[model samples]
Target: MNSLSNQSRVTYSGTGRRKSSIARVRLIPGSGKLIINGLPGESYLQFSPNYLRISYAPLRTLGLSTEYDIHVKTKGGGLTGQADAIRLGIARALCNINPENRSTLKSEGYLTRDPRVKERRKYGLRKARKAPQYSKR
Candidate 1:
């Protein structure tokens, strides 16, 4: 059995932010297993499955064939936000793994944080852009 200490590896750290959430991730070469806050798959399921899939999609799409074990600690956001943060962390880590691939990753816009978000609702409004009941009377 291969022990973690015995393996030759490079460590990469990245911070991802989305909405009110932030995710910190560490990537190291190993078998593909995502460890979020020291817990494995079970912990990941705490978040929405679609978000998890979206977050991990980049790794495969980018052709990062090297097996990696990812450790992520995310806080302060909803499931969607956390997923986006996770995606950003993975993209950054991939770039660290290979500087030459920066162009590829950058072109995909994985490095940029999505700036769009919900606007604050006004006191009299039901939602950000929605107005209160209009009366002709």
Candidate 2:
């Protein structure tokens, strides 16, 4: 009962990361539905249209927006990072579906991973880049 075996459908998977967030995405043929961490995408994202749009960008680029169901398990960072991670994961899964999808996804810049991350804090610094003021008598 834990897994679906009735359909025997093809499943494609990919992993994405942004900032500190990591997402594992799976694609399966079905009516358009997005599930994240066992919750519906809309509610999980607090019904933010911007977040939904960002996460769905890759599928929209391929014109296969309604043809596949996206299931994601993500952790770390915040919603924005997670959303971008989902986008990259979906793009990769789409490429797994068909190599031809790579050109489209790459041209749309969905295949590129954002390398920016929080810098490590140095000793005597208030934050990663902020430091205590030096006073002159």
Candidate 3:
């Protein structure tokens, strides 16, 4: 039972970003649970199946979804970006637990930080790329 004590205390952490969102994730050995910003993951994520799936995709890929609990603090961007960030963060933390997991995570593209972001609106444009209606007269 002494060995279990040491294992219980081990924690893996990672950071992930997507668009304007950032997620700091920690993986701990426990029954699968997700806590985000101190709130239950399901409620915080509005119980959306897609969001939950995205957040757990990494663990599911490794067949360890129920072996670890995920704790994350994420901010910025919309839910979509936050969910994606959580996915990446979980993947990275999994890699930290076992380097061999890196290859599988990478192959699934979960380790890639999405670079897309909102473009700054130009001074003369209505939005990032929209401009005044063209006048051919």
TM-score of each candidate?
Answer: 0.78, 0.94, 0.91
For TM-score, the strongest prediction is 2
Candidate 2 regions with alpha-carbon error over 4 angstroms: 1-7
How displaced is residue 22 in candidate 1, in Å? 1.2
> What is the TM-score of candidate 3?
0.91
Deviation in Å, model 2, residue 64 alpha carbon: 0.6
Which tens-of-lDDT digit does each residue in 1-137 have in candidate 2? 53676557789999999999999999989998999999999999999999999999999888999999999999999999999999999999999999999988898899999999999999899999898998997
If ranked by lDDT, best first, what sequence of candidates would result? Answer: 3, 2, 1
In candidate 1, stretches whose alpha carbon ends up further than 4 angstroms from where it belongs are 1-9, 46-49
Q: What does candidate 3's lDDT look like per residue over 1-137, in tens digits?
A: 99998877989999999999999999999999999999999999999999999999999999998899999999999999999999999999999999999999999999988898899998999999999999999
Error of 1 at 107 (Å): 2.6
Candidate 2 global CA lDDT score: 0.94
Residue 128's lDDT within candidate 2 is: 93
Task: Score candidate 1 by lDDT.
Answer: 0.80
Off by over 4 Å in 3: 1-8
Candidate with the larger lDDT of 1 and 3? 3
